[model samples]
Target: MPEFIPLISRQTIQNRVREIGKQISRDYQGKDLILTGILKGAFMFMADLTRQIDMDHDIDFIGASSYEGTHSTGQIVFTKQPDLEYRNRDILLVEDIVDTGNTLTKIMEFIQLLNPNSVAVCTLIDKHERRKKAIPVKYACFSLEKGFIVGYGLDYDEKYRNKPEIYDLKL
Candidate 1:
């Protein structure tokens, strides 16, 4: 086990999420918006964010996994699917973080097959430098350095997911 220091505090994360929610609410006002939460990791952020999105929108969840322990598994497993028709609808994909871009790439590709009118991504944090694939993020709260982060839904070996603050591993 390694010691870790808090990176984004709980209050800071809440404030940032409010800001992001305001932006999304403004952008999709009066439009049919479908929120797709990338499950497990994004669950906390998605729940809080949706409460601030003042719009008539539907919510769905998808569970995808590309990591095990502290490493990328290099494969994506979609354990759950979003049960909604995406055709001609604006879709927002909510994610906890975008790291390496492999998982996001596969997710975007899979969503595109549904023929949505538009598809955009919103992430709580982004590791821009670690992106291996060219995946564009439409909305992001912050760009983080390359580090092992946990908390606010991110986890290490399935621990720390419930931590209110975000912390970086000392190693």
Candidate 2:
């Protein structure tokens, strides 16, 4: 087990998510929007963000795997392929966190083949220092410079994801 330190509270996360949702609502108003969440981690965030957004939009999930334990293997494998027709639709990839960004980059490469009208990213936690690729993260709720995080749908070996608040996980 990892040592857990309280980081972002549940209330704080909700408030920020609400703010992002409002901005997204304004930005994509009168446009075809699809909220495609990167699964497992982003599931909780996607559900909460969906309620916060005051607009009609579609919800979907995509899965890509890169991490084995705490470290990323640098190779992305799609666990779940995108099922929606993205052609001419604005697709927003929602995430729980962005680390090296290799996963999103690979996912984007695949989605581009679908010929979506526009594509963007939204994340609950943004780790800019670890970014290895240029990701279009349009809406980010929180930014963390370092540390492995857990809770609020983030996990370590698939544990601690049920916690409502975010925590710094020290191995």
By TM-score, the best candidate is 2
Top candidate when judged by lDDT against the true structure: 2
| Whole-model Cα lDDT of every candidate shown, in order | 0.90, 0.92
lDDT of 1 by residue, 47-123 (tens): 99999888789999888999989889899999998899999899999999999999988999999999999999999
Query: Candidate 1 lDDT (Cα, whole model)?
Result: 0.90
TM-score of each: 0.96, 0.97
Worst 10 residues of 2 by lDDT: 128-137
Write one digit per residue (lDDT tens) for candidate 2, span 1-171.
Answer: 569999999999989999999999999999999999998899999999999999999998899889988888999988897878899999999999999999989988998898999999999999977889988889899988998999999999899999999999998
